[model samples]
Target chain A: MFGRIFHLLVKEFLQMKRDKSARFRLLVPPVIQMLLFGYAATFEVFNVSTAILDLDRSQESRALTDAFVHSSRFRIAVPAASERDVRDAVERSDVQVGIVIPAGFAELLKKGRTSPVQALVDGTNSNTALIALGYVGQIAGSFGQDYARNLAERTGRALGRPMVSVGLEERYWYNPNLNSRWFFVPGVIGTLALITIVNLTAFAIVREREVGTLEQILVTPLRPVEFIIGKTLPFFLIGLLEVSIVAGFGMAWFHVPFRGNPLVLLLGTCLFLLAALAIGLLISTVCTTQQQAFSSNFFVLNPMFILSGFSFPIPSMPQALQWLTYADPLRYYLVIIRATFLKGVGLDALWPQMLALAAIALGLLTVAVLRFRKSLD
Target chain B: MAGAIVEATGLSKRFGAVMAVDGLSFAVQPGEIFGLVGPDGAGKTTTMRMLAGVMRSDDGSITVDGIDVRAHPEQAKRHVSYMPQRFGLYEDLTVEENIRFYADLFEVPRRLWEERAAAMLTASNMTPFRKRLAGQLSGGMKQKLGLTCSLVHTPRVLLLDEPTTGVDPLSRREFWQILYSLRGEGVAMVISTAYLDEAERCDRLALLHDGRMVHCDTPAGLKAKMPGAMIEVAAAEPRRVRDAVQKLPGVAGVLLIGIGAHIHVDDAGRRLPEIAAALSAAGIATTEIGEVAPSIEDLFVALLENERNAA
Candidate 1:
């Protein structure tokens, strides 16, 4: 059985090597996708155009406007002549956010009265809006605090306890810069490997069936288990190789940090790939045609990617979907990848996710083997 | 040589409402080419699959080299190599690679691999093209290579389903030569073919129709079982002669053979004058009328038509 599986592996690899197009497919697309998506699939919101309407035209309002212009997150638009001008700029998408300061805005701060500053924000593309709003809120709050301190000192009165005592200092651990690329590049490593390995493995058995080669092998003495292993081992190795190369490129080209142990990454990658390849084998077992397999891939991959918390945070998803995501191996893999890439987390911190991945891989492989045996029978 | 290497008794198979092979019984001896001859959907392929232990039979039993096919398909499969209608060879792999793949699957020892492979390749005239990709080969060469791959492990029994269906005449002949050589070496072979001419080459043949065996015998015996004599009638207008004579009494079946028509009739000595008279009255002048020995094609057609009429 070992000799037979070894022979099948050799044949599969030789065939892949001889086909020039297949060889190119093995190495090229994943690299291109890794680089392209690393740059493209980022979440950092920058250069957002903002329009300011300051009715007061005073030092305090101007200082707040200056802060918006100086920050990397927003580009300053022409100062609006009126509230109507702010509306026009926002309506035309000339500005994503409009800051409308009231007529007594500077006078109110001098009197230590609460000023209601109306900041109109576009809610489309919610993630960008959310981040931009946070930045806007911080600038406004700090401006108020600075004004309050200046007023207290200039009054020559004993500074009593202030009304607003709530102050927050939010610290982002690991990714202190909040670089979205750092989060995306590592996730892309798992994603690229999953797509390539699943796609290739899905076609392995189905292609043989379509070309009439699988039936020829069935009459031989080789068992189904041996065939499954022989067919999957090379692809399993290729999946891991893809992970190392893409992860390396991510680190070198994109400067995405790899702070975790290399061995943990390897272990997590293998477990994730084993589950992915097993899902592909499951698709192959049920599909009789290559077209059916290709269509089924979309069904499997789209849900897996969307629910994986790769780009979208799992915590924010609906409760039902969050529960559903727990069943997806990619969800656990993303946890391992993102944590290991940014947090420098070791196995002790990541054991639960890793264990979930191992369990999923085992279940998927067992189901695939059972389905394949049924297909043969 | 060896006693019956493959014995299938009272075999039956069904697909939904259709009975593909029903109540079929046959045995193949060592060193013999047993042909399962049938038309499309006649259950030749299905029966071959059951005998090879890849397909389950709805009823009855199949044994290959003394191993019950249903009970131990792997063990039964080890003793046989079944080349399905489309002989599956990896198009990208070289001919040599395709042959060695099967050898490895069968776990043929490295020491015996060269000797076993060389014999098949040389017999099939594929030795010179060993390096050629299977996709690049001509249809005939691919078929020959498919056979070589199937024989890599030196199986005792071979079940080939239409292995030579679409090959060129020369390749078909060469393929048969390889099978004949294997037969000489005490290999029992069960081959299925739609071509009646190829059926004549088998040591014994079982004619199947609608999942039931209508007749089973040696090629000559099948021909001899034709219930009546066959008369090859020719005239100026062949279609007119065929139309006129087909209506005559005692005529069982009429089929076109080349430009002439071969008519099956009961007691040709008695029906010969009546056929001549009928064609004469239709303004078709008969040039020849005589009893000819039935070929395998003629016997198959006549038997199938008889079954249709009885049904």
Candidate 2:
């Protein structure tokens, strides 16, 4: 059985190597996506366009405007004299955020009285808008404090250094800069591997049936388990190659930190791939042609991608869907990859997910192998 | 010289409302080439599948080389090799690679395959094209490669389903030559084909029609069982003469052969003159009429007529 499986694996590898375009597709997509989404797929708001409405052309308002312009996070895209103009700019998406200073804004601050500055923001994309809102709040709160301190210095009032104060000193572990790229790159490694390995293995067995080669293989003494191994081992190695290249690219080009052990990463990746390949093999067993296999792959990958928590958080999903994610190998692998890629955690921190992924893989592969063997009979 | 390599008795199968194969029984001796002759939908494939142990028979006993296929299929499969009409060849894999895969599947050692594959490739005239992808090969070469793949382990019994259906004439000849060589190697073979000429090459064949055996005999034996002598009437207006001749007293059947009609009579020596006179009376003048040896085609046409008339 071992000898036959070895032979089958050799033939599978030879075929994979010969189909140049297929080979290119298998290895290239993960790396390209790692680079593309590494830079392009980001949630960290930078260089946000801000529209300013300066109804009061005073030093207080001008200083606030200067602060918005000076900060790297906010760039003043437009300066308007009227509130309507600021609203229009935001509505037209010309600016991601808008700030409005009222007519008596400086008088109220000098009297140490209540003053409100209106902030307008585009909320179409909630994440970017939320991040922009945070930057704006920080800038405006500091300006208010400075205004209060300046007024007290001139008037020599008792209100000095403000009465009430709450300080927030936030520290982001692993990614100190809170770079979204670091978070996304590892997820891409898992997601890309899932999509490619599933597609290739899903369509492969059906294509054999279509081309009339599988019937030949079935007649041989090679057991169904051996046949599955022969087919899976080559693609499993390909998936590993893809993960290493993408993970390495993410670290080298995108500069996502890799604080975890390579061995743990590989083990998690292999376990994940085994389940993915089994899903593909199960799909092939159910489908008769390549078209059916492809559509089935699409149906499978879409749900797996959604539930895996690759892009979406499992906890944020509905209670039912969150429960459903436990069955998805990608969900566990996403956690494993993120920990390995960014958090710099070891097996102690990740073994639960690794064990879960292994259990899922064994369950799926058991079903796939049984279905395959039954189909042959 | 050797006990039967295969013994199939009372095999039966049904697919929904259709009885695909009914009560098929045959025994093949060592080194014998047995052909199952049939047209489309003739249960040839269904029987082959049962013998290959991929499809189960509803009721039957099949033993390949003394192992019961029904009782223990996997063990039986060790000694049998089946090549379906679409003898599944991996189109993307090269010819040599495909062969290597089968060799591995059967666990033919690396050293043995290297030497055996060289000989097989040369016999199939595929030595120069071993590196070509199976999809790129001509239909005949692909079939030959499929056969070679099945033969890698030197199976005791080889079952091929319509091995030459789409092959060119020359390649068909080359393929048969290889099969003949395997027979020399003492492989019991069962082949199915619609072509009567290919049937003639088999030592014995079973004619399957409508899920039942219509005739089972050697090619000549079946022709000899033709209820009457066949009178080949060479002439124009063959169909016109067929209508007139079929109505004659001793005429059993008539099959159109090009511009002629082969009319089977209870006794052609006595019926030839009557057939000639009848054609003349009907004003459908025949050029010449004489008794001729019946072929497999004749046997099929006669057997079909016999079944329909009985029904």
Candidate 3:
């Protein structure tokens, strides 16, 4: 059985080496997707276009405008002469954020009177809008704090220290600075492996059936179990290699840290790949053509990806979708990988996820084996 | 049957409402080339697949080299090599690579495959193209490669389903020569084909119609089973000759050939002169008229026509 599977591995590798499209597909897309997701598919909202309208034209208002311009989060895309201009920039989506300062804003501040500034944000993409609003809040609050400190110094009552409002001291652990690339690059590695490995294994078997090679192989002394092992083992190896390349690229290019035990990562990856390849095998068993296999892959992969918590948190999903995610191998894999990459946790902390992944892999592999028959019928 | 290397008894396979192979029974001895001669949809492929242990029969059983196929197909598969009509060759792999893959699949030892592959490729005239990709090979070379792969393990029983259906005449002849050479090594071969002329090359064949075995015998034996002598008559207007001769006594049927017709008569000695006279009487100038030995095609047509008329 080992010999047969080894020969099959050799054959599969040779085919992969000779077929230009397969070679390209196996090597190029992961790198491209790593770059795309690492840079583009990010949660960090940067360079948000802001339109500013300072009605007071005072030092206080100009200072606030300068703060918005100097901060990396907001780029002053338009200088508004009137509220109409700020509203137009916000409405046309030319600027994602708009700030309008009222008249006497600096006078009210000098007199220690209450002052208010109106901020407008486009909520079409509520996530980006919310993140941008948070940045705006931070800049405005710091500016107010500075003014309060100056007022205390002038009055000589609080000894040049600003009066404290409710204060927030925030520290982001694991990923300091909340670098979204560091968070996303690891997830990209998992998602890319899932998509590409599933497709490779599914299409490989379906191509055999389509080209009439599967029937030829069945008549040999090689058993169905042997054939299934032989067919899938190569892809399992490829999945590991692919994950390594993508993970290495993520680490080197995106600086996503891999702080966990190498063995733990290897175990998680093997379990995940087994589950993914088993899904591919199951799809191959049900489909008669490459088109059917491809569509079926899309049907399964989309839900798996959505429920995997690659981008969206599992708890944030609907109740039924959350339950559905329990069955997604990618969900467990994502947890294991993220915990491994970010928290540097080993099996003690990740055992439940590892167990869930192992169960899923075993269950899917069992079903796939049951479905695959050594007969054309 | 006792000495047969491959035996199938009362095999029946149904696809939906169609009985693709109904009550099909046959046995092939060692060193024999058994042909499943049929038209399209005649269950030749189904029967071949069943015998090769790659398909299950709805009824009956098959044995390869005394191993029960359905009960233990994998064990039976150890001794049988099946090459389907469309033998899947990995287009990206070279011819040598394909042979090695199958050799490995069958668990042929490295030394054994090296020797067997060298001989097989040389015999098939494919040695020069060993390193060429299978996708680059012509239709005939692809078929030859498929055959070589199928035979790499030197299987006890070889099943080929329409191996030469689309191959050129020369390649088809060459393929049969390879099969004949295999016969000397005591390999039981079951080959199916829609080409009737090729059926004559088999040692014996089972003639199938609508998934049932209508007749099973050697090619000459099948021709001998024809109820009457075949009288071949050539004329400019063969249809006119057929019209006149088919109406005469002892005439069973008329089958048109190129510019002639094979007239089936109960007694060719009596009907030959009468057919000639009738064509002359009808003003259809005859090129030739004589009793001719029936071919497997003639026998098949006569048998099918007889069954249709009987039905």
Candidate 4:
């Protein structure tokens, strides 16, 4: 059984090595995708173009506008001539945000009266608009607080005598720096590995079925256990290699920290890969055509990405949806990978996720083997 | 003659409402190329798969080299190599790599594997392209590679399911040559083919129709069992000739051959004058009329027609 499996692994490796296109597909695309999605595909909005309608034309309004320009979050495109320009700029996406200081903005501050500043935001891309709004609000609030303190000191009154005294001390646990890139890069590693490995293995068996080579393999003296092991092991290793490459890029280029033990990470990745390859094999057993395999893979991949807690937190999802996450090995793998690579957690902290991944891998492999045997029958 | 290399008794397989192979029974002797000749959907592949131990018979038993495949498939597999209609050859792997992979799977000793791989490659004429990936090879070359991969382990019995279905005429001939060469070495081969001409090359042929074995005998013996004389007629209009021939007093069946027609009769030579006279009366001129030998296809068609009419 071992010999047969080993032989299959060797064949898989040789096939991967000799086929230049498949080799490129197996080795190069993941690294390219990692860099493309890691650096270019980002959720953190920055360098947002803003249009300012400084109606007051006073030093205070200018200072506030200057603050918005200096901050990396917003880039001032042009001083709007009218409210119409501000609206048009935001409407056309020429600027993402528009700040309109009222006509009495400085006069109100001098006379000790409140001024309402209208900030028009483009909500077309909701996430970008939300982040830009947060930046705009922070800048305006800090400036107003400083202005109030100065005014109080000058007037012989204390601004600290307000009825509401609210303080917010924010601390980020796993990702202390709150680097969205760091969070996303690690998730990309797991996602890329899952997609590539599952697809490769799924196509491996389906291609045999398509080309009529599966019958030859089944008739061999090799047992079902041997055949499946042989089919899956090489792909498992390839998946590991891909994860390592993506992780290396994350660490080297993105400077994402690897907080977990290398051994634990490697072990976790191997288990996850086994589960993914088994799923691919199972898909292969079910699909008779390459098109069917590809379509079925998409069916598996979409749900995997959604439930794996890559884009959204799995725990925050509804209970019924969260239950579905248990079957998704990527869900456990993402936790293991993120906790290990970002938080620097050890086996003691990540053993449950690791164990869950192992169970998924074993269960999927068992089903895949049984299904493959039935397919032969 | 040295226990049957492959034996199946009362083997049956059903797909939905259709019976693919119902009560199939046959035995293949060692050192012979046994042919299963059938048309599309005749259950040849299902029977072959069961005998190869890759499929379970609905109700029956299969023993390959003394090991009951239904009961101990793994043990049965050890003695047989099945080359399915589409032989699985890893397209990404090279010819030599494919051979080595199968050899290792079968646990052939390293030294023996190298020798066998070299010999198999040479025999298949794939030695020059040993390093070329299977995907790069032509259709015929790929088929040869599939055959070589199956032969690498050197199993006692070889089960081939329509191994030359889409192969070119030259490659199909070469494939059979390799099969005959293997037979000379005392390997039993049960090969299924849609081509009756290829079936003629087998030492014995099992004619299957609608999932049941209609006849199993030497090629000559099966042809000898054809019940009527076949008369070829070249007429001015083939269709009218066929119509006139079919309506003739002594004609049993009229088959349209290329640019002519073959009329099956109880006594073709004796009735040729009458057939010619009938063709002339029907306003169709007869160019040629003579007794001709019936092909396996004709025999199969006749047998099927008989069964259909009876049903």
Q: Write the per-residue lDDT of candidate 1 for residues A204-224, one digit (tens) a residue.
A: 889998998887898887778
Candidate with the greatest TM-score versus the true structure:
4
DockQ of 2: 0.58
Greater DockQ among 3 and 4 belongs to 4
lDDT of 3 by residue, B180-216 (tens): 9899999999998878788988999888988999999
| CA lDDT of each prediction against the hidden true structure | 0.86, 0.86, 0.88, 0.84
Error of 1 at B235 (Å): 6.8
- Per-residue lDDT for B1-311 in model 2, tens only? 14999999999999889999998888999889999987788899999989998877899899998899988877888899999877888888888888888887877789998898999999888999988888898888888898888988889999999989898999999898988988998999999987889999999989998889988888888887778788899999988988888888988888999869999889877898898888889998778889889888888889888888999
TM-score ranking, high to low: 4, 1, 3, 2
Clash pairs (backbone) in predicted model 2: A212-B88, A213-B88
Largest lDDT belongs to which candidate?
Answer: 3
Q: Per lDDT, what order, best first?
A: 3, 1, 2, 4
What are the per-residue Cα lDDT tens digits for candidate 4 across A1-377? 67677677777776666678987777788888888887786778788998999999999898888888899999888679999999999888899899999888988876655677889999988888898899989999888777777777777664322224489999998778788888889999999999999899899889877886677677777776776777777787788788888899878998988878999889899899988988899999999999999999999999999999998887789999999999999998888888888788889999899899989988988888888888876
- Error in Å for residue B253 of model 2: 7.9
Q: After superposition, how far is residue A319 of candidate 1 from its true place, in Å?
A: 2.9
Instruction: Compare the candidates by DockQ and give the number of the best one.
Output: 4
What's the residue-level lDDT of A201 in candidate 1?
Answer: 92
Give the DockQ (C-alpha) for candidate 4.
0.73
**C-alpha positional error of residue A186 in candidate 4 after TM-score superposition, expressed in Å:** 2.2
Model 3, span A82-195: residue lDDT tens: 999999999999999999999999988887766798899999999999999999889998898888888888888544355757778998999888888888888888999999
**TM-score of candidate 1 versus the correct structure, residues matched by position:** 0.89
- Using DockQ as the measure, what is the rank order of every candidate, best first? 4, 3, 1, 2
* Steric collisions counted per model: 0, 2, 0, 4
* Span of ten consecutive residues with least summed lDDT in model 4 chain B: B300-309
Which run of 10 residues does model 2 chain B get worst, by summed lDDT?
A: B220-229
